[model samples]
Target: MSYFLLFVLAGFIAQLVDGAIGMAYGIINTTLLLSLGIPPVVASASIHVAEVFTTGISGLSHAFFKNIHRQLLIYLAVPGVVGAVTGAFVLAHLSERFAKTCIVIYLTLMGLFILYKAIRMKSTAKAAVTFKKSRIIPLGLLGGFFDVAAGGGWGPIVTPSLIASGIEPRYAVGSTNFAEFFVALFSTIVFILILGISVTSWQIFVGLLVGGAIAAPLSAYVARSIPRKIFTFIIAIAVILLSLRMMVKLIFF
Candidate 1:
């Protein structure tokens, strides 16, 4: 029961950041779950299943804020959805132990990557490189694949990459969050197909829903002046620590 409440709190905090900044939910959830020794595909499947609902709430909120770029959303979503199916299928076939180790490594790297981006976002860095709009799909495909492949990559890859490509921050966040719905939705289907259907746990599913629902509307209405510097730093540290702990266990025992 205590662990369940902690899980709910984790979901609440993860969703709050994700709703506001458009990233971290998947990575954060993945890092924490993996540290607890949950199987990789099971963790990914559970999070994606939860995200199907959370991202929907988030998408509607972003839309209400008028923060989305419709063209970009479509371009990203179409390819992302396709990549998600492929990635989910591939991962579902992996042995649990091997998959768990690989995910810890990948997610640890992403923690550093996200930390760097968070600092950049905090510092008001300007994007010097701008890509043609047509360049969007390629990255979207990769983001989609990695998102399900490692349990989360859509926002971490797409949101900052889009901003770095000279897309506006809010729009990039908004569009990425919007497109993630399809990514999670289709990915969940593929996971169900490959692994067979199981709820994983209703407590977790409901916890995510409750947290995301509370945060989504609040984020959309007041998406400004979040203390990115400190919040993101803490998130970065948490990801690194959790991931490293498991890596050490695998290496030693």
Candidate 2:
């Protein structure tokens, strides 16, 4: 009972963060779950199930308020989906420690990248970098791979890259959320097919759906109204905290 409550509490907090930042739910939730003794693969899989609903609902809401680069989405989606599927398969066979190590490294690097971008954005009033299809493809593939390998936390890895590459912050975040919808869907299917499903997981899934449905619209509103600098700062802080948590667990706990 206590364990279930812990997961529930984690789910609520994760959803709130995710709603506020447009990402980080999985990274935070998986880390918390693993710390609570869930196997890494199971934690990843369970989180994916929750993300399916969260990303789907959030992506849709963002799409309404934000302009999505359909061309970019198309170019990135194929490689991203393929990479996610491949990573899921690889995760099924890999050891938990090995997988966790990879996630820690990715999160640490991603966090630093976001922090740097946030600092740079704050200091500069220059226009964001222009988006190009050539750059989007590679970023999407890399993000998808890490996302799948590390339980769908690829937004931290991808979002900052998009912004750094000159994409507008709002579009970058929206497109990332759009991309995550597919990644989460692919990962959830892989988990269900390869690992089998459980009722407890289903409850988590419902909780994610409920929380996400409520938060997605609110996030879209906030994303549009908030100053770009403030948004970047918030996201940067989230990445830093989440990354530090993962690193600490990897090194000490």
Candidate 3:
């Protein structure tokens, strides 16, 4: 009962951050579950399952707030589903150490890139790097793959890249959160096939689902209401801190 309530709190906090900034729910949830002695693959599987509900609610909230870019959401969703299925298969059969390392490095670099862009967004400089639509396919693929393989990375990989490409922070966040629903659904399906749908603790699932559901609309409101400059800075700092934290955990823990 205590752990269940703790997970409720964890889920609320994780979803709050994820909904507002477009990342970290999986990382946060999975870390807590792992500390409770769940296996890595199972932890990832459980979180993805829980995400099915959270992301769905979150997607609807973003839509309600008019934060999503429809075309961008479509482009991200299809390839992301494909990549997530593939990643789920790979995680079931293979070692993810190398893949996780590469993803962590990529996240760190992207975080820095976003921080630079945030700085530029604050300045009067006309210099900008536009994000080409052509990049969406590959970005979706990679983002989906690493998200499952590393336990949580879709927002970390996709949102900042989109924002750096000069997309508005709100749309990037909203679309990414929306697309993640599909990614999580497909990934959860694949995991259920391979790992059979039982989480280490039912509490983890229910707590996260209920809590995340509660936060979904509120976080979407945050994304919609926050100033672009502040939102961008928050994203930059979140990515940097999350990537660095992942680095430290990977090396020391």
What are the runs in model 2 whose C-alpha is more than 4 Å off? 1-12, 30-45, 92-110, 120-126, 194-201
**TM-scores of the candidates in the order shown:** 0.72, 0.80, 0.90
| Candidates arranged by lDDT, highest first | 3, 1, 2
Between which residue pairs do clashes occur in model 1? none
Candidate 3, poorest ten consecutive residues by summed lDDT:
122-131
List, residue by residue over 92-161, the lDDT tens digit for candidate 3: 6656667777878987888898888777786443323245668988889989988887666899999998
Candidate 2: lDDT of 169? 65
TM-score of 1: 0.72
Candidate 1 whole-model C-alpha lDDT, 0 to 1: 0.72
Candidate 3 regions off by >4 Å? Answer: 34-43, 92-94, 123-131, 194-197
Which candidate has the highest lDDT of all? 3
Model 2: weakest 10-residue lDDT segment is 198-207
* Superposition error at 221 for model 3 (Å): 0.3
Q: 114-134 in candidate 2: lDDT tens per residue?
A: 667667775446545456778
Q: What lDDT does candidate 1 reach at residue 193?
A: 73
Model 2: how far residue 75 lies from native, Å: 3.3
Q: How high is the CA lDDT of each candidate model?
A: 0.72, 0.69, 0.84
